[model samples]
Target: MSKSKFTTIGRKILMALSGFFLMFFLLQHLTINMLSVVSPDMFNDVSQFMGTNPVVQFALQPVLIFAVFFHFIMGIVLELQNRRARSIKYAYSKPGTNSSWISRNMIITGLVVLAFLGLHFYDFWVHEMTVKYGGGDMSGLINPNDLDSGYRYHEELVAKFVDPVRVIIYVISFVLLSLHLMHGFQSSFQSMGVSKGKNFIKKFGNVFAIAVPALFVFIAIYHHLQH
Candidate 1:
């Protein structure tokens, strides 16, 4: 194959791989966060383990950070390419209106998600991992229930959720995320050239796109209600 063709294929492959990696990461993250809804104690236990465990702290944390960074960079590159390709301006165009709004505003949604991620890391990660485990700070700003006796990270999470403004932001962010995932889940497969059918795949993709995002929304709402 020609060099240009090879480059295009390689870029697409990287996008697809990074997308899949991030998707799996989201599922894992959701599972861990959802533990708070089930049992605060269990959630705190897991958070303590994740925060303090040498393997996870030293190995998995770096990998997770790299995955997020790669995903964001590739997304920006692909989006710029897409915008450049669509040179013609649309006049009252409603193409793909049947698709979810998230499908249409992925970059915007991604930015929202990224913003929330920063807030999340500061709220939980920095306090639990960096301060507690890394000996950075013990200012009692995070978990206030006696760190020496035992870490109570889960209580901090619940306290954060109780704030009306924070709850609203969390809900809004997750709603956008749901919309983003509605497109992202299936688009990842299509980007990888794994699907060929125009009819069956399209229908299946629509279902998956809606379902995954809805699941996330439900989880978020459930937590909000519990708080």
Candidate 2:
């Protein structure tokens, strides 16, 4: 095969791997968020561990960021190639017939997902890092029922969702994520040549795509209503 063909295949493989890794991260993140709604103390303890864990901070976090960046860059490249192919007069462009709307509009949905991710990092990650590095005054951020806690994980979460605008944006973003995952889940499997038991993969993707995002939306609303 030509170098260009090799590059295309390599890109697709990287995209699929990065996407799968992110999906795992989302599952872990959602589980922790759900815990916050049920048990605030437990949530705080878990958050503290996650924030302070040297391996997670120095290893997994960096790898996760790279996966996100690689997935996004490859997605843009693939989408551009697809667009150029469709622009050719002789190329067939029966998108809906060949694939679902979510699959066709992955670029749009992915962009929305990325936007919310940036907002999320700004809201929480930046603040956490600032406090950790002793640059910001996180003096009064206290958790529920704790006077000595350095950061208020639960309080910060509820405060953000109490804003109706942020809640609406979060809900919309989760919906877009659901749509994106509906196509991406099974598509990733296909790209990686996981053809055995295709029906199971499709069913799992459909259920997971709906359930995970719905759960996340519920978590957001739950926190919003708490305040």
Candidate 3:
């Protein structure tokens, strides 16, 4: 009934909305990344299109970046609020052992994922932006001088992943990401008040959380093995 309670609820809903959007984005991203293994040419084509498309570059890209930041920032805010409220209300309460470890450590996993995002942006996004927008060449060719050499996207991906240390780091980060999603996916639904078929949703979330991050791990290892 308190205003702070209402605000917390509102923030949860907003966070849930942003989280849902981000989950969708992650799936889409994984699909695109998977193309590198299935067909490098196809991956390059899609990457080239995504890179050069004005609609994506000038419109959706900014929105995606905003959603990424907004989701994590709101998550941190809600976690702090929860800690404050718990201090006041559960001062003498015993810690619930029934809770899953992932649920208790969402903030930790979330922060790790946040750091991974920075590495990802630096590794791919920033470099690609420099090449596409700042390098004075719109052609996606590996060598702009020779058009027959093929696109640079797939080459860049494989080469960047060739370093074993980086691949290991990526795998570890994705494993933690899976744990984060396991708790987050169901919680997002609950936050949105979708209680019908809750059990089924939870099962699907478990599958999805594992499958997506596992595939990402596979992708990193697969590319690293190419060397």
Candidate 1 per-residue lDDT, tens place, 9-90, comes to: 6777777787778777777776777787777777777876766677986898898788888888878887898899989888
Residue pairs with clashing backbones, model 1:
none
* TM-score of candidate 1 against the unseen true structure: 0.77
- Report model 2's TM-score to 2 decimal places: 0.90
TM-score of each: 0.77, 0.90, 0.93
Error of 1 at 48 (Å): 1.3
- Model 3 per-residue lDDT tens digits across residues 1-227: 57575576788899889889989999999999999999998999999999989998899899999999998988888888778875557456555767888999999999999999999999999898888788978898988999898899899899989899899889889999999999999999999999999999999999999999999999999999885
lDDT of 2 by residue, 15-62 (tens): 888889999999999999998889988887788788878898899999
Score residue 128 of candidate 1 by CA lDDT. 66
Which ten-residue region of model 3 has the weakest summed lDDT?
86-95
Candidate 3 Cα errors over 4 Å, as ranges? 1-6, 86-96
lDDT of 3 at 99: 82
Clashing pairs for predicted structure model 3, backbone only? none
